[model samples]
Target: MITSLDHLVLTVADIDATIAFYTQALGMTHAPFTVADGSTRHALRFGESKINLHVSGAEFEPKAQNPTAGSADLCFLTDRPLADWQRHLAAHGTRIEEGPVPRSGATGPLISLYVRDPDGNLIEISAPLQP
Candidate 1:
């Protein structure tokens, strides 16, 4: 039914911090966008999906008070999935809980690993074989 994972949204406390963490730590480039209100959202491009981090100054209170961890898992296409993640995470001091598992689901078979972002949100890095 689903063609591919398009994007994932995350509500974070520190917008710049989250941006820096993903850009510097995970090697993602912040893509350009338009912000309608004073509130803003950042889109970082990593392979196919764009990880979005939104900031809504005081309008949304729940995200500021209570944050969710590992609510969503994201994957990136890489030539060396495991090695690239290992070096990147190590350089940024991010620890891996579990990893590099061969997942089987509707998305098909893929090699993946899991990690958390600055706000403790879970992320997956997967390399899907050619169809």
Candidate 2:
């Protein structure tokens, strides 16, 4: 059984653009590392989680059967309120596809905002509802 998520790989069209979006818009940190083959690869770090970047058609060995962009729907928890997220996204020129709508989260009810990344991945940023 999995204890907790360590990292996930994202098949992206442009690594630099993806990095810029996550770092600037989402406040994640960029971490570039050298692999076993001595090739440099990039990742976006937030909290204890990281998303590894792999260019489409040049993915590492043992990748997903159909590694495609724009196919993933990911949700992330935040301490900030939904209103603050709206302004932040606007300031960064990132569009919100939908919501401050209510949805069920892993723990309980949440208020979430949906946005798209450079690769068109659906990213839901949620804040847990207070009692």
Query: Which candidate gets the maximum lDDT versus the true structure?
Result: 2
> How far is 88's C-alpha from truth in model 1 (Å)?
2.4
User: For residues 9-109, what per-residue lDDT tens digits would candidate 1 score against the true structure?
Assistant: 67766778878878987788988576665655468888777866665443333353543533556555566658777877888888876777887644577
Worst lDDT run of 10 residues, candidate 2, spans 65-74
**What is the Å distance of residue 94 in model 2 from its true position?**
0.8
TM-score of each: 0.69, 0.97
User: Deviation in angstroms for 37 in model 2?
Assistant: 1.4
| Cα lDDT of model 2 by residue, 1-131, tens digit | 97899999999998899999999999999999998999998999999999998899899888999999778899999999899999999999999999989999988999999999998999999999999
